[model samples]
Target chain A: MKRRLPLIVVLVTAIVCMALKFLNLGERGTTLATDLDTIVQTSYLFAFLFGPIHLIRLHYSNVQKRRVNWAYSAFLVGVCAVCTVVFFINRIEGPVSTFIIDSITNATDSAIYAMLGFYVCSAAYRSFKLKNVEATILLIAAVILMLGQAPIGDAIIPNTSKFAQWILDVPNSAGMRGIRIGASIGAFAASIRVILGLERSWTGSGS
Target chain B: MDWKKLQWIDVRILYVIIVVCLLIPMFHPVGLPVAISDNTRLVYNTVESVPDGGVIWVSHDTGPGNAPELNPMIAALARQAFRKNCKIISTSLFNQTFGPVTTFEIIDEVAREMGKEYGVDWVHLGYRDNAWPATIRLMIENIIEGAINRDWKGEPLDQMPLMKQVKSIKDDVDLIFCTTVGSPGYADWMTYVSEPLHIPLTGGASLTMYSGVQPYIRSGQLKGFLGGLRGAAEYEQLVGVAGAGLAGMDAQSLGHMTVILFLVLGNIGYFAAKRAGKNQ
Candidate 1:
């Protein structure tokens, strides 16, 4: 019953969603969709607590066990606790809350993301070698794209921007659309499998 | 000099060189001209074509990681929209913590500079939970209900003059400008909202996503779109504002040049090593 019940719920919800999306139920259908959306949203709000609860549980267990890098876990739990308290006390949009988010959270996030720039430079220098025909083509395309994206590309090679735009408009876009279409069909099949209870890995019991 | 050794130069030296190349342009501006692309022009013209006072739904679906590339886009959009007396209804669906706060700050800053009242000219609905196509679909039906009657700062939507004028996206919105980084972004808006309702969808994406969105542009599903900081810079130029996008172009130009230079050096070393090996 434990496993069957959840699968039943998924099957019903999936069918209802698909029918609502594909059928022409008119005004009634619109209202039903909206209501379903609200229900989903409310459920999501309730599920929101699951993340922090799980985080606290895992980290607190780590702290209690004195596991490797438990200090970082403890620090994370501490920050989450303080941030939660601060947010509740001062509201999410409050000056202090905003400062903590903007100054601490956002700054750290941006700094870490910025490190990607350095790594990308190093990666390109080391890995973008011309070893064979495929490598040569890729290398040429990369150089063209790099030049085309920058203002100096046009300055150095006239019409380089136009060449770059063509590559993006033609081959790149064609490849992306193929991937997108393939992925969409795969997603559709996956959804059907989930609906039919063939994909039960999500139920935590594995398929 | 052993040419093959060039490929093995310490990565730290390369990093320092890139840093210097990026930083030098910041201190000494090269003022490289940015040519506008058809894609960027289409985005600008779409916003321009919206009747004065038309409401634009600016969905800033981004995060702190892509903020530098995307924030300038919101600022530029706000400047252009406000200049023509258009109203803006903003939301950020990307992240609860990152997108909402940064988006509100950028739009609010531009709004203040333009002397546009927040409630009347623009109202940020803030970050909705990640209920995506559904949340967006609800907004198309009724904005007030979709946002739960609260503005970004927890203010009542009914109290806001802009919100009062805007009831539903279907009836009120003129354009959907989304700055997207990933899923629940332009694709969701295009498929679930814009295409069904016939509202024009257009906006920018990170350069990484530029190619992926090109098919939509070709199909006219997206009126046109911007591609990362370069696109933002071009839009800034068109809007006649010198903001972050324009400011960062020189650095970007030099950085790209530096990478290209290293690629050439690395390739030369690669071929030399290959030739040496074959001869031996």
Candidate 2:
């Protein structure tokens, strides 16, 4: 019953959602769009629950077995409980709710981003190389683009300013555009296949 | 995977060169002249030709995760929209937590600097989940039914003069701008909204995903595209505004240049050692 219910929901939702696009219905079609958003919003609300669930399940198992991180069980549950309380109380209309939202936003935005710089630098250090001809060209192009992009490129290389501009527009754009067009064609083909139910990647209930 | 046996690239060398390239630009912005491409030119001209009071659907499809890169384009794009005296119908489908808030903050700040009004000139439809289908649906529906309780000053979409004229997504929207993390974004817009209806769509997306979105641009599915921070930098340049994109470009450029120099040096080192051994 549980499996059947979700599948029925998915199939029904997908059909209705997909059908709306094909309808001759003029202005009324927007009502379906509003309904679609509500579906997405509900999905997101459920996602907020997973963060706590994972933390609790992991720690609960650990504590029951007296594992190394067992003590974290209490900590995880306690924090989740407190946050849940605050979340429910704030209601987007409450000042406390605003505080909780702001706190999450700040940490996710600034703190997370601040740490990403180091990771990006580390990744660049370990991986960036000219292993072959294309790599060499890319490296050279990188220099041109980088220098040309920055204020210093014009100073160091006399004509780099205009040169960089040409590179981004012509060669880089051409290469990038080729790949993008290819991908889009592929996606369009796939979407058509899906609409026809030729693509069943999202199908399968037996497994 | 032997942890200690792994060869480590010299981190300090990379840092030194990156720092030097950045420092030089601070003192001498090298005046690297910028040239607008036909595509970028199209983006520029499209905005330039927009009739005054035209309504633009500006979808700030980026989160704070990509705000550093995409926000500059939004700022510049907003500047152009405002300068053209167009009414911007700004909204977001991504950044459920941050999408609406950040986009609004940016538009609000830009509008304030430009002396634009809130409802009369622009209206924020705010964050809507299920962005792809929702956006498509909204475009089909026209009236924003999602933002129910909130208002410009505790008012509704009907009360707002700015939104009154826009009955559906297609009614008054002159152009569609979808700035996002990658293909899912531009692709979604192309498939659901622009391509099917023949609506002109443009994009600003992550650099890594730029190539991936090129086909849509080539196929005329996308009118113009801003690829990564550099694209944003160019937009800022066109707007006569200097911000994070230009600054980041300085850093990104130097990093690229330094990596190239190291490649040449490494290749020389490899070849020299190879040739010396061959002779011996």
Candidate 3:
């Protein structure tokens, strides 16, 4: 009953949603679909509660076990507590939260992201070897694209930017479309499987 | 020509070289001449065509991580839209309130500089916790109560002068410029909102997300897209406001040059080593 009931609900909901898109059942159908969507959206609002709970639970367990870097767990818990109190009491734009987000969150994230430059250089130095035809082609294309993206590239080679745009507009688009199409087909098949109740992995074991 | 030794240089040395390369450009700007791309001009043209006082929805689907790349574009777009006296309705899909709200705070600075009033010239619809499709669908159907009943600060939408006529996104908005980092973003806007409602959609995406928009641009789903810092720089140049995008490009150029040099050196070392082994 547990599994079957959920499967039945999924099939009905999927059918209704799909039907709603194509069939114009006048004002009543529109209202029904909108109301159904409202319910779904409200349910999504409840999902946000899970994120903070999950974070607290994970860190709480870490602190309890005195795990490696448990001090960081304590710090996480402390920061989370302070932010929650500050937000609830004084809104997110309060001086404390703003400072934390701007200085700590934004600054740290940007720094970490900026480090990608170094990593990419190191990775390219180690990995971009020209031992084969494919490697040579890839190296050439990479160089062209890199040069083409920057203003200096156009200055150096009058039309490299145009060629780069062609590479992006033509070959890149073709490859991306091919991947998107395959993925969409796979997704459609999977959706149908789910709608038909054949995709029982979602229902966990015993189904 | 000890190619083997060159190949085995320590990674830290590469890091130091890149750091120096980036630093030199930052302290001493290159001021490279930026020529606008067709797609960037398309984005500018679309935004420029928004009639004075037309309401346009700016979907802020990015976070602090993408701010360096997307923020300049966002600021430039805001400046352009505000300059045209367009009513701005902004939304963020990131969580309860952090990403979109903070993004608005940045845009608010621009709005203030342009002497545009919040809740009058621009109104933030705030974070709608629903999936992008549902949120966008509700917005199209009954945006007033369904999606944005209150501002992010819990102020009623009815009180906001700019939102007075915005009962439905489909009826009210002139254009959508969605600056997004990843999924549940431009795709959702394209699938659920723009395509169905026939609203012209433009996008601003990180350089990494640039390629993903090509298919949409090709299919006419997106009017155009701004590709990362370069796109932002071009738009800044077009808007006649030299912002971070233009300033950062010098560093970006030097960084790319450094990477290209490394790639050439790496490949040369590999081939030379291979030839040396063959000769031996």
Candidate 4:
């Protein structure tokens, strides 16, 4: 009954949601859908509770075990606790919360993100090679695109910008569209399988 | 062939060089001439074409990491919309706790510059967690219910005069612009709001995600799109204001140059090493 009840609930919810989306029940229908959405949204918020609980449990276990770099885990727990308490006591816009989010959190995140430029430089130096024709074409196209994005590209070769645009609008777009179509079809099939109960991997077992 | 030397350039040296290239340009910018593409112009014109006293919904679907490339576009849009005297309804589907702070910081800066009044001319509906397309769907049905009781400031929505005219997303807004970095973003807006509600939607995306957004723009699902930092710079240029978007272009240019240089040197070493082996 445990597994069967959950599966039934999932099947019914999916079917009802799909039906609600497709049907036009007039103002009453819209009201019902809105109510359903509110319930779903509230449920989502409840689900968000699991995230922090899981985080604390994992980090606490690591700290208890004195795992390698357990000090970092301890730090993570400390930061999480401080932030959560500050947020609860003073709300998200409080001075402490603001400072933590904007200065400490945002600054660190941006700095980490900025390091990508350096990594790209290093990665290109270490890994990019001209082993074959395709590699050469890729290398040239990448350079052209890089140049095309910058004004210096125009200064170097005025028409390289146009060539880059053609590359993106034509070949890149074509390839992307092909991938998107296949992915969309796959998603559609997956959705159908889920609705019909054929895809039960969510049960943590392969079908 | 001394290509062997090229094969083993210390990665730290490359990192130092890239940092120098990026930093030098920032302090003393190259002031490289920026070209405004047709798509960027389309984004500008779409925002500009909103009638005086119109209301527009701006969905911020990105956060701090994307601030460098995506934030400028938000600031630019806010500036343009404010200049046109458009009422702004700002919301986010991410950063449920701190996203409103980011949204307000951008919009408030623009509002101060334009002397626009909050709760009178603009209001932030704040961040809605987990409920995305549903949030959008409900907003189209009833904005007040969807946004809860207050703006991000905790002011009651009933008292906010700016929301008086906005009863539903379908009826109240002139256009929708989503500054997006990933999914539950442009796609969600297109699916839940634009297509069903028949509202015009535009997307501003980071450079990395521009390709995914292109097909939507091409298919007319999105009215237009802002392509990364360059697009933001172009939008700033159109409005005759210079901001971070324009300022960062120089550093971006130098960084790209550094990457290309490394690629070229790397390849040269590869081919030369192959030839030296053949000769031996």
Candidate 5:
């Protein structure tokens, strides 16, 4: 029941969504799909609901067993209680809940985004060795693109800026176009598979 | 065999080189000049050509994680939209991230500075789940019945003056400009939103995601594209504007250059190691 029930629910939802997408099939399909979307959404909200329950249960059990940091349960409960009260009260659509939600949401978003800096830092460091001919080409292209993409590149080396523009406009676009074609082709194949019942990837097991 | 095996270089050196490269652009932006691509130029031109005080839909399908690229493009586009006194109907799909809200915040801020009134000029349709399928259904039926309004906080959308103009995704909007992050991202926006309806769609995306989305632009499935921060920087240049993309250009340029340097160094190290092993 743990796994199978969710699987069954998901398949029904996918089928309903697909049906409502193309076929009018009366309002029945539309209603089912909308309801399924709501249910899926509520399930996410339910996570917030169950989070405290899970934390309390595990922590209380740990306290009973006298686990380390068990005393911190009081702190945890206090914070959770405050948050819940705040969520419901401020959730009445005031700046209160909005502030809480937005700050946390924005901060989380910003933090994850900040990782790009580090990733690029690492990626560039690795790319420098020109591990092979491909690396060498990539190295050259990356430099030209980096230089051309900015105004400063022209400031330092004016012609390279123009050359970089050509690369970005023509070759980059061409390469990007090739990839886009490949992606659409892949999307088409995947869609066909789903329509034909050959692809049950979304279903996890069955549909 | 030892020659091949011995050539494997330590990974840490690469990390250091990339960091150094990344720092260069951070401190000094190269100011590379760019001739705006036709697609991006169209995005600007489209806004420019629109009737003054016209209504246009800004369909935001991205989150903050990808904001560094999309934000500047949208900012420049919004400036153009604002230039023509164009009304913006901003909506989003991936609402989990604060980017849409931030985008709306920017619009609201810009609009406020211009004495633009809310609902009079711009309306935000906050994040909705299952964006593609919901959007597809929305295109067929009216948005009043569609799932677009399920996540909003204001009084029911019917009351919003801005929403008064839009009957559905198919109506009341002049153009659909979607700045997206990655795949399973704008693919649906293109297939379901733009392709079926023939609404002109365009925007900037992250570099990693840019290569994959280019075909849509090529086929005119997408009216245009601003590929990552680079694309956004170019658009900013054309607009004769400066913003986050411009500020970060130095970082972007230096980062890319450093990668090239590392690639060369890594190859050299590999060949050297190979030759040393052969001599031994």
Candidate 6:
């Protein structure tokens, strides 16, 4: 009953959604779609609580167990708790909440992201080698792309930007479109399978 | 000195060299000229073509990781839009934590500088839940109902003068400018809103996603799109304002050059090692 009930709900929702999207029911269809959308928005908002609840539960368990890197988990739990309490007291857009987010959260997030730049530099130097024909082509493309993105690329090699744009517009766009079409078709098939109760992995009962 | 030894240099040394090269531009401005691309110019012209005081829906679907690349696009867009007396209704659906706050800060900064009053000239709808096509679909029908009738600050949208003017994206929005890093972005806007409503969608994406969006650009679903910081820099130039995009170009130029130099050296060492191995 546990699995079958959810599958039944999915089937109904999928059929209704498809009908609302494809069929020309006019004003009535529009109203039905809006009502269904409102229900989705409400469910989405409720689903928001699941993240924090799961986060706290996982980290609290880690802290209690004193597992490896438990100190980081404890710190995360502490920060999450403090932020939640503070947000409740002062509201999300309040001065104190804003300060914490702007100063601490944003700073840490940006700093961590910035570290990628250093790693990328190291990786490009180490991994970008001319071992074979494919590696040589990749290395050359990497050089051209890197130069083309920067202003100095034009100064050094004229029309590098134009060449880069061609690569992106022609070859890259073609590849991307093929992948997107294939992925979309795959996703449609997967969605149908889920709707028809063929895909049960999401229910944690395995497919 | 062995040629093969070039590839064996400690990664920490490469890091230091990169840091120095990147930092040099910060202290000493290069003022390099940025050539505008057709894609960027198309984005600028699309916004320019919006009827005076027409509403633009800005969906800043980005997080902190891509913020530096995309935030400048928003600032540049705001500058151009405000100059032409366009009203902006902004939303951030990428994240509840960073997207709303960062989008608000960037657009609000530009708004304050341009002396545009909030809730009148512009209103930030802020972060909505990731309901994708549904939330955006509802927004096309009714903005207030879609966003639960509240602004980012949890204030009632009815109180905002701009909200009163702009009710539904389908009827009111002249253009949809989305700076996106991933899904629920330009694709969602194009498929559900822009194509259905016939409103033009134009904006920027992180360079990482630039190639993926090119097909849309070719299809004219996106009028034209910006690619990463380079795109931001070009748009900033066209807008006649020097912001972070312009300021960071010198560093970006040096950084790219440094990487290319290392790539060349690494290759030299690799080939030399290969040749020596064959000879031995």
**DockQ per model, Cα:** 0.77, 0.35, 0.65, 0.68, 0.32, 0.75
Ranking by DockQ: 1, 6, 4, 3, 2, 5
Native contacts retained by model 6, as a fraction?
0.76
Model 1 lDDT per residue over B1-280, tens place: 8999888889898889988988898889988898889888999999999999899999999989898889999999999999999999999998888998888889999999999998999999988888777787788888998888888778999988788788999999999999988987899998888998999999999998888999999989999899989899999999999899988888988999999889888888888899899999
Q: Find the 10 residues in a row with the least total lDDT in model 6 chain B.
A: B5-14
Per-prediction fnat = 0.73, 0.34, 0.67, 0.63, 0.46, 0.76
Q: Candidate 2 lDDT, tens digit per residue, A1-207?
A: 754555566667667767776676565766665667767766766876786688788877877788886677767777778777877776654677656556766556866864665456656445445568886676667667666555556667777857866676567668776776798799988766655555555666322
Ranking by TM-score: 1, 6, 4, 3, 2, 5
User: Model 4 over residues B1-280: C-alpha lDDT tens digits?
Assistant: 5876776788888888877887898779878788787788888888888899899999888877787888888898898898889999998766664467788888998999899999898998878767766777777877887778667777889787877777888888989999887766888888878897788899598888887877777778888798888788888898888899999888888888888887777777877888889999
TM-score of chain A in every predicted structure: 0.95, 0.62, 0.91, 0.91, 0.56, 0.95
Query: In the order shown, what is each candidate's alpha-carbon RMSD?
Result: 1.4, 5.3, 2.1, 1.7, 5.8, 1.5
Off by over 4 Å in 5: A1-85, A92-105, A127-144, A152-207, B1-32, B145-152
| TM match of model 3 to true structure | 0.94
TM value for model 4: 0.96
lDDT of 3 by residue, B1-280 (tens): 5875677778887788778877897789989998899999999999998889898898888766777888788889899998999988888885344566666776799999999998889888777775657767877977777655787777888877777777788888899988878866798888888898899999699888888789889888899899988899999999999999999888888888888887777767777788889999
Q: Lowest lDDT 10-mer window, candidate 4 chain A?
A: A1-10
Per-residue C-alpha lDDT of model 2 across residues B1-280, encoded as one tens digit per residue: 3222122546566566666876786776644545454556667777776678787888887776788889888888888889888889877777665667778888999999999999888888766545356545554555555455344234577877887777776556777888978534777877777776667888688776665665566667788788777778777888888877776776666656665565555555555655566879
Residue-wise C-alpha lDDT for candidate 4, range A7-122, written one tens digit per residue:
68888988778778788778887777878888888888888898889999999999999999999999999989988889999887678887888789878877887787677668
Model 3: per-residue Cα lDDT over A40-142, one tens digit each: 7878777778888998999999999999999999999998998888878876778877777678877787788777756777888899887689988888888
Candidate numbers sorted by lDDT from highest down = 1, 6, 3, 4, 2, 5
Residue-level lDDT of model 6, residues B182-259, one tens digit each, is 887888888889998999999999998888999999988899999999999999999999999999899999989888
Better of 4 and 6 by lDDT: 6
